[model samples]
Target chain A: MTIAAMQGIVKRYGNELALDYVDLSIHEGEIIGLLGPNGAGKTTLIHTLLGMIPFDKGSIQLFGRTEKVFSHENKQKMGLVTQELTVFEDLTAKENLEFFAGVYGLKGEERKKRVEEALAFVGLSSNAGKTPAKFSGGMKRRLNIACALTHHPKFLIMDEPTVGIDPQSRNHILETVEKLREQGTTILYTTHYMEEVQTIASRVVIVDQGQIITEGTVNELIANIQHEEKINIDVSTPGDVPVERLKGLEGVKNVHVDGSTVQIISTVGSGNLDRVLSLVKETSGVVGIQAEKPDLEDVFLTLTGKQLRDGEEE
Target chain B: MTIFTFALKRIFKDKTNLIFLTLFPVAAIFLPEPEYWPLLPYGYHYFGVLILFVGIRLTGLLVEDRQKGVVKRLAAAPVTHFQYLFQNLLAFSVIVIAQCIFMIAGGVIYDHELHEPLLLLILFIVFSFTAIALSLAWNSLYRNKETSFLVFMCVIIIMALLGGIMMPIEMLPDVLEQLAVIFPTYWLAEGMEWVVMGEDTADFLLINGVLLLYTLLFLIIGSIRRMG
Candidate 1:
């Protein structure tokens, strides 16, 4: 079942187009990673879906209701974990959860029970009384997630939930997200981290220049790219390398050189590895060579022609 | 109920705010003054100043919330914009009323006789609403907390100084006295004077009516600017 759908979302800031006729759909119990570089319309799309900002033209349907103005009931069914920590610094972890849960219309013993459960879920029960002012970066991030989950929203939207936390907390949050998926929650996770999406997202949507350039499962996206193998060669005599000679090799799709190292992208089922290795050895004194399958990072680089962390053209 | 609870909790979380809210009004009651006043008791006039103090503190709380992104969090919640404003205003009104009660009790303990205690109570309640509206209106005009606080404090101090809360407006030059009439503080204090003097019903009605008009105007402007 389709849990949420955004069709032809068009948004502009003055004369600049922030989102240009973007479309996205999420299925039940699936973690859809909304991947993009900075200013790639990822945050704009999330804000539009949450009705935090109005779009110039579009329609959003959550739970089968297609209304431009989301009713309070619709908002109650969705949870958000923004990239920035939104928890109150003056309020304790428990108070923060209680306040947000109250905003969601939870009350009495039920509200208390849910707040407790959320704290436990985020592994902050021991420090429930501590204010976010004293928490480490990772604990604050966890509390932010717990505040959103206190209401038990079926559709969770996390925008870079693990942006600047410790490795343990990042892993814990990823595991928690997986557990939420197991419990049948539909999540739309946005991040510029390809590895994060590779680990958790069932489907990946790559957005660039205010539109989705490509989207599919990790393997599907990788398979869609023409490059099947990526070969890296390091040479001892860097100045003696011939760049054009490797590009002329059979089945070599593309070649990039950086100082002493040479990267060759090649097509599948082509006996080009030995030829490329021999050519590199003859041209430049080879120190080490590696050939590996193409992954999502390569797919992103191929489609967008830049690293995920690199800024795109405005 | 949830929003009210949340607002109240937020207001009380800062112990310093509670301390100031309690101590400042009590201190205002003890300022040296003449034994015999012309229009109303010094206590009643000082009570008006207490209401403005509460207004400043409440507005400060709101400014802090906006600076901290709590307003943005609430905006994304299930609550509507109107509901958020209403709940916050309601919570502030409760605090203002409590302060008013403390002022009235202090007056009684000081053996200050009020000619129309019931009418004075009504005037304070109406004036409290006006203060809330004014604070909201002032908050909507500035985005930065420091600027908002500075502007609001300036307005409050200037209004209180010129509108006879700190000193009788009659003592000011004719031009300054005329300017005082343009402020809500002047009209609210004037209403209290009428109540204490056992003035004609028309005089009382006109003063309170102007207070309500100011409340309506401020509320309209605040809501329009905030929603925009």
Candidate 2:
């Protein structure tokens, strides 16, 4: 079942178009990655879906019904884990989840069981009674997600959930989301990290300027790109046949020389290493070689002509 | 259990509120015991306004929620707007009552004053609810705290003058008194005065009922505007 849908949604803020006629939908079991640059209306779209903001045009539906703009029943069926630490900093993790559970009208044994389940799912059980101030950023975010899920909403909206955390916490959060998806929850996930979408999102939607440019599976996204092979080689002999002969190799696209490194792009995943290696051996140079498959980041860069991280693309 | 208890526990965590709750009302009692107290006319109304100020400080709790980004999260959560507003009202009313009790107790202990506890309780509940509703109203309209505080002070001053807090309705010109009839503060102060000076339970009841009605009105309006 399609859990949520947005059609021709338009949002404006004082002459600025926050979201312009954007169309997207998520299924009951698929985790859709809403990828975008900053100022790209990802948060705005999430806010609109949550009925926290007004849109100038279009329609949104949740669970086959027209959206009620934050109605009781609708809110009860949805969960939000925002980027910022929305959990009460003063309240312990358990207290925060308990408070949210109470707000959802959960009571007595039911609320306690849910809180325990959520805390355990988020791997925050040990930190249950600890205040957010004493917890790390990653732990707090996990608690935030746990609090949001205290009522067990079927649809989840996570906006940049892993903005800045240590590697270990990011890995933990990603793993937890995978577990949630395996349980049949639909997720509208947004992030600047390309690798995150690779592991969890079944498909990726690239949003920019209040609209979706294109969306597809990772393999489909990178399918049409010319250079599938990137070869980074460190050479010793140095200047012989140097750069020109390397670019001339069969299936080799381009070669650039910098200091002690020669970078080569191979057309397709043609195992361009062998031919390049032969040429290098004849030229009395290349020593080290490493080839890697193009991950989603390369695909994203190839499709958008923009880098994932804020401004390092150029 | 109840969200109210959770809110009470949350409010108590601040600790500063507990200190202020006691100090505010006691200080109000001590400020004017005799000649020095009489130096300012209608001192009771000033204390009432001070009580409202205490209420406004409690409203700053919303500021903390905003600062922490909890408001947005709550807005997105499964809880309805009614639940959120009620939670705030529950918390706000608890703190206000805490302060009001200290003031009333100081009246009994130091001033040797005694009136109807039921009347006073009704009046205090109304006052606290109104104060919180007004604060939420200001917060919804103006995101800035200073602006809301300014508007609060202006309203409280206007209320102090028109409602007979500083000057009784009988002393005011007929036209101004008629104008005072429209302000919530007038009702708030009138109810409080009835609780203090009048022994007739009906007068106290009448005044307290009006304030309670105002409290409900503001609470509904503010909650609707904010949550809706």
Candidate 3:
């Protein structure tokens, strides 16, 4: 059964549209990556779907029932780690979990067992008594997740769970998320980090200007977009060479020379790198040359025609 | 019972809050300086009133869950809004009722006849429920808990003093007394005094009526804020 279906969702704050006729659906046991630059209606979509905020016009169905039927039982099936560090800082890690367990009406020995499992799941069993004030930034994030996970939700929604965290913690969290998905928890992960989406998400939804611009599986999205392969030449310095000289190479779709970096967009990934490297010797300052694959950023740029989204609040 | 479990857990874990919610009110009853000292068998009435009456503004602390995002998160769980508010009321009411009972015991230990235990309990409920309304009403406007808490405390402190939390209600000028009477805490304190001292049963009924009406008005207003 489909887990969630939100159709033609329209939400407004005063005159500014927070969500503009947005349509999205989540299937059972699938990880959907909500991708957008800031203010791209990602938070609005999550909040609306969770029934935290009411929309101006739209219909929401969860578990094949209307939003009203999404009762405590339905709500129990989902866990959320919000975009901010909101866990109580003064309480110990165990205390935090107990409260959440209580939130789900889990009590007595049943709650104690669940709390222990959740603490261990987040790798925080050793620090169960530690308060957020004494913990590092990563620990706080994990505690927040543990609070959400004590209920063993079927679906999880995390907003930018890895932003500003150290590489080690980020990798650990990403791995934990993968493990959750493996255990059959459908996931909706939102972030501006392309590598994060590439690593964990099966499907990518790109939102822009309060609407879903396009969405598909990661590979399908990559296949649909035609990005000019950008060949980067690390040179000692750029020269006054004719820009057309590089353009003359086979498969070279466009050429732009900026300072010590030589950027050439090639139409075909094959033979272009080789031809570019062979001609690199002609430039005296060419130090290193590399050709890279197109990523979500490229697909987004190609689809929206804007390098950065205008996510400023009205 | 649901709110009780949740609130009980919260109160048990919180150490800093012990002073603000409990010990401080008890300490207010006795003082090293006579100037700041709380009222006796007489002011115990205001004490009961202040204990629960401040609940009007203090309820802001609980409703603040939404603005702080805690309420929204908590709401998503197996709990209802009524359960949430009920738990919030439980957390403070336990403290207020305990303090009242403790004071009554103290009065008995001193061999001063405890005038009306049931009436005092009723007065304390009126006090606490009114505070609940004030808190719920203000929560919709303030997004941050600390700011809302500070504002609520300051406003309530001023109102409590003017309403006779510190002084005898009869000492005030007739005009000021009437003005202060409008504040639920004043009527609550006056009603409690009547309960504990065995006088003004008529005034007690008026205060109880005002307290019920005030609590209802706030509950209605707070429900509106919660809806938004």
Best by TM-score: 1
DockQ of each: 0.63, 0.61, 0.46
Q: What is the lDDT of residue A298 in candidate 3?
A: 78
lDDT of 1 by residue, B43-116 (tens): 56776766775676676666666666666666668988788778888898898888777766776676667667
lDDT for each residue of candidate 2 in B45-121, tens digit (9 for 90 to 100): 46667767766667766665666677778788666557666767777777777666766666666653435655665
Residues B1-228 of candidate 3 have per-residue lDDT tens digits of 545655655555566455555565565444232333233354464454455434543454565456556766765566677777767766766765676666555555555444676676677667766776766776666767668777777777767767877677677888888889678778766675576465657778888888889878877877765533
**What lDDT, from 0 to 1, does candidate 3 have?**
0.74
Q: Name every residue pair that clashes in candidate 2.
A: B32-B37
Candidate 3 positional error at B39, Å: 9.5
lDDT of 1 at B108: 66
Q: After superposition, how far is residue A33 of candidate 2 from its true place, in Å?
A: 2.0
* Chain A fold similarity by TM-score, each prediction: 0.83, 0.85, 0.83
Docking quality of model 2: it rates as medium
Write model 1 residue lDDT over A1-314, tens digit each, in one string: 88888899999999989999999889989999999888898988888888888899978898888764478888898899988788888789999999899999999999999999999999999999999999999999999999899889999999899998888988999999999999888999999888889999999999988999999899889888854678889998777777788889888888888888888887776788888888778878889987777777788888888778765532
Please give the range of 10 consecutive residues that has the lowest summed lDDT in model 1 chain B: B31-40
Q: Which candidate is the best by lDDT?
A: 1
Write the candidate numbers in order of decreasing DockQ: 1, 2, 3
